[model samples]
Target: MSADRRRILRTTAQLAALTAAGPLLAACGQEAATAGGTAAAAGSGPPHPHASPGTPTVLTPNRIPSATPSSTPGGSASGSPPALPPLAASTPPEVVTGPRDRPQIALTFHGQGDPKLATALLEAAEQHGAQVTVLVVGSWLDQQPQMARRILDGGHELGNHTLSHLDISSMSGDQAYAEIAGCADRLRTLTGSIGRWFRPSAAQYATAEVKAQARRAGYEHCLSYDLDPRDYADPGAEVVQRRILGGIKPGSIVALHMGHQGTVDALPAVLEALQQRGLRAVTASQLCS
Candidate 1:
């Protein structure tokens, strides 16, 4: 062949080789890009849709660390506590009982008076492995600031029972609003969230205006009781225990008081009776939710 022809033949061969290598190189680059994308995704994890900004995500319902007192009331076992759904506007204004078919009961206390009595009540419940809801008066919480944290640390629930334990049903709209909001404010300050329940003072059920005020204060449920043992009447411990055990049924919300020594004394027997009947004593939130 002539020199020019030979050079032309060599050039054509080199061009064919380059064309054959293009797709292979492109495929390799695409594979590397995909692998890098997968690794990046794996490292970052999935987006948390339900997480609140600036708040630690609670994977389980274990007791949150108390903000005061530097100690938990009673240490909790290692397990997921029951989760309570967020309060919604459509939630019932008053819940007198929980699901009737469930063998669960909620024992709620009116929180006021002597702090020592409150502590004793809590200790009694803890001994029986029971969790109760406390409707704390704002003035009482003001008197015993650490008590709010204590209730939470003990794995119990605290709720708003108004500011001064006033008869909110008879108050003006603004006054009722203040009653609810004041307690809510204290709870939020102490726990980073408002309470889960609200109960009207000096009344079994909240009035329409009171319920509206409670909703405005961030409480969706106003707790009422299906069973009232009249523990506040200073009934003897035997009477208190008899009253509770006599009327209690599945899903009953038993109303009691924290200030009564008789109620505290009756707690052990009441808890034992509940166990004998195969009913679990849970917080109001747990039972209702």
Candidate 2:
């Protein structure tokens, strides 16, 4: 071959070698990406489907500050969604109650079923000048995207209740993480933060793996209830009222169901009773903070 032709052949050979090494370099990059991460340390899994672009940034569990209370009913004057407060760290990331020194309690509702019933509950609580927490089910929020804003607009705090309300304790680490993150993504998309708290589904307390997954999903607290009135069983409204009244104490976190009309019926009396006993109702974040 002529000198110029020989040089051209050599350059083409070098180009082929570089092209063959491209995938190898890419593989090294991926390994570097995974090697130092906690999720990779556990075990790699498929990316979460609900994981979407531009999801609000997650707050660090230990460093996130509590949100200032908003005075407006619907949204800020700028019409932006309110930011969620960071949960105070619980070593186990689970809380059954708040400080007993203050005569205040948190009434939290599981968001499910009828949106109208949930609306009624909010309206009723507003009438009593109470602000409670609503731990939203991911699928439920999917059904009613506006409800997330509605909950915040009503001045109630919001928290995660998993993606499908599955029994997260039974899920694998990856599965559990997906459940937590999936719901968190929805919350973050709706509001500017991942809300303040997380609660496990079909159970009161989070398992060890579930707690780790919740931390990964950016929750600092896993809220468990101190008082459950069993209104989900469709027990009579009076019975629900009696159970709530009987069990309530200072700093109690009471769990109720938004799906049940019985809870709707019981709430007016429940609020009246709390007031009569000189106990004020506040959001779970406020109660804990």
- The prediction achieving the highest TM-score against the true structure is 2
Best by lDDT: 2
Candidate 1 all-Cα RMSD: 17.7
What does candidate 1's lDDT look like per residue over 141-222, in tens digits? Answer: 6557677867877888888887666567777777888778877776776666677889987788998998888888788788
Could you estimate the TM-score for every candidate? 0.72, 0.73
Candidate 2 per-residue lDDT, tens place, 1-289, comes to: 8999999999999999999999999999999887747543442231231223221222232322223434455555343556545544642368889888899999998877787988899999999999999998776665566677777878888999887676677778888888788778777766677887899877888888988999998987799998988888888899999999998999899988886888999999999999999999999888876
**Backbone clashes in model 2:** 0
What C-alpha lDDT, on a 0 to 100 scale, does residue 50 get in candidate 2? 25
User: Residue 54, candidate 1: how far off, in angstroms?
Assistant: 40
Off by over 4 Å in 2: 1-74, 77-79, 83-92
Scored against the true structure, residue 72 in model 2 reaches a CA lDDT of: 50
Task: Indicate the worst ten consecutive residues by lDDT in candidate 2.
Answer: 46-55
